[model samples]
Target: MIRKLAFLIILVGLGFAGVGGWQLWHGSVKQHETMKKAQALTVTKKDPVKYKDWDPIKGETIGILYIPRLDKKLGIVEGTSPDQLEKGVGHYKSSALPGKNDQVVLSGHRDTVFRHFGEIQKGDDISVDLPYGTYTYVVDHMKIVDKDDRTIIHSTKPKEELVLTTCYPFSYIGDAPKRYIIYAYPKKK
Candidate 1:
């Protein structure tokens, strides 16, 4: 019985490993292809009035985000739904878009798309490719907060900021209780 149990455990472990490996490989490939496409995209200048009238559908590809520090690229979807997150990062619909006012909030699954987020530094550059134009942001700070923290989402003052959120302890398995927040501001000339 003990030998059979051991064999079963090994099988389960192997299954998990296979799935994890496939996810990593597939996500990386998709990101690379997406990044190439993003670089070639061109859009009109962003106008605040046009954004206000825009309607977004869940799971729709909204933009592309590139983090030069991590050499990572990911597609930004419209909503933070489970299905959307599986493909890439999700943009908070309530927040402003890339070239608009207020904070543009983006969220991603830590184990997958945001695995290298922990390595980001204050001076790192992050670029967003939107339907309007490409905007660049420089990381300013990072913080860990409770999962339920509302301060991360709500802005206090009028500012053009980009906020990236993911599960804390980037490598943690299962549902993480804490949130990791990266605050970035528009790059200055």
Candidate 2:
């Protein structure tokens, strides 16, 4: 009776594990499709967005991002706050949108998605090619800050800076004490 009972338990456990795996895979596929569709240009139907009209309201979820220096291409999530982490890239609804003169702040997972950032070099070219036109940026500086610094999100004096933030010490086990910030300046024509 003991042997039979043990086998039954193992079989039930395996069934649960299979169900969990399926759920994860299914959720990931759905999120990917949503992000892909979000990245698709919806504003093209409207008038062109002027660099002058750039404002925080323009912040929107991005589909794909390319960094030449890191040799990384991945999807971008907006709304980096704790809540938005579950869905794809969540845009910082309050921060200035990309291509604007102000800070275009973006964040993502360092381990799984944008991990190549660890290999980024200064003077590297980072570009975001949206459905509209290509927005180019040149990496200027990279700094690691303490995680509590809410001040970093404020608009810069010049408003032409872009800051990308992620956890520091890439492999940190728990919450990261510091944040790795990459500053990039928009490249003009």
Candidate 3:
């Protein structure tokens, strides 16, 4: 009877591990596909492309986010839905686009696309490459706020800014109660 109980426990543990592994693998595959689509939208012309007057639908690939300090590039999707975030970083739909002279907010899972988010420091460079143009921002500051904070998303109208958010306590195993926020401003030309 004891042997049977041990076997059942071990089996359950393995089952959990298998499910976790599958989730990670699936998210990675989706992100890879999203990156490919975003890359295809890259504009290589000598002249810069103008920003379009249209908004992306949920789950749409909008652009690519480049973190120079981490040597990482991630796809930027349209919304923050679970399906969209599973693909890559999710861009808040109501936020302004690159070069829009307003605020742009982006969020990603701490364990996935933003695993190295804590490594980013002030003065680091983050750039977004969209079909229209490439805009670069320099990290200015960072803060830790409650997960329920609503002020994190606000208007920076007339001035362009970028905000990157991820769950705090990067090592936490479950939903973190705090948020790590990084504030960046346009890089001087």
Candidate 4:
């Protein structure tokens, strides 16, 4: 009877590991595909007048976020839903896009696309490449706030700001209680 119980426990453990592995593999595939699509959408020159009226649906890759310090470039999707984030970093649908002279908000899972988010710091250069143009931003500051903080999404009107958010306690295994917010402003020419 003890042998049977041990076997059952091992089986269950293997089952969980298999599921976790599969999820990680699936997420990697989705991220790769999303990045490919985003790269295709990027243009060589800035053409604000070309895609000015472009609108993307949820899960659609809208741009590429470049973190110079991290040497990372992640695709940016249209919405912050789980499905969208599974593919790439999510851009809050209601937030303004680059060159809009307003706040642009982005979010990503702590374990995946933003795994090294904690390594980012003030003064780092971040850039977003869209079909219309490539906008560079310099990290201005960072803060930790409750997960429910609504002020994190407010408009910066007349100023083009980029805000990146990820779950805090980067080492935490589950949903984090707080959020790590990175505030950046457009890099002047």
| Residue-pair clashes per candidate | 0, 10, 0, 0
Please give the lDDT score at residue 89 for candidate 4: 94
Local lDDT at 153 for model 1: 80
Local accuracy of candidate 1 as per-residue lDDT tens digits, 1-189: 999999999999999999989978887676555455445543455554666667667766777898998897787878887766776888988887876667899999988889878999999999998776788999999999998898788752477999999998777778899999999999997
Model 1 error, position 22 (Å)? 5.4
What are the runs in model 2 whose C-alpha is more than 4 Å off? 1-31, 42-46, 50-60
Cα displacement (Å) at residue 74, model 1: 1.4
Best candidate according to lDDT: 3
Determine which window of 10 residues in candidate 4 has minimal summed lDDT.
43-52
Off by over 4 Å in 1: 18-52
* TM-score of candidate 2 to 2 decimals: 0.71
List the RMSD of every prediction in angstroms: 2.8, 4.5, 1.4, 1.2
TM-score ranking, best first: 3, 4, 1, 2
Whose TM-score is higher: candidate 1's or candidate 4's?
4
Which tens-of-lDDT digit does each residue in 71-168 have in candidate 2?
A: 76555555665535444444566676665557777776565445666788778888765544566788888888888988888877566777777888
TM-score against truth, every candidate:
0.83, 0.71, 0.96, 0.96
Local distance difference test, each candidate: 0.82, 0.66, 0.93, 0.92
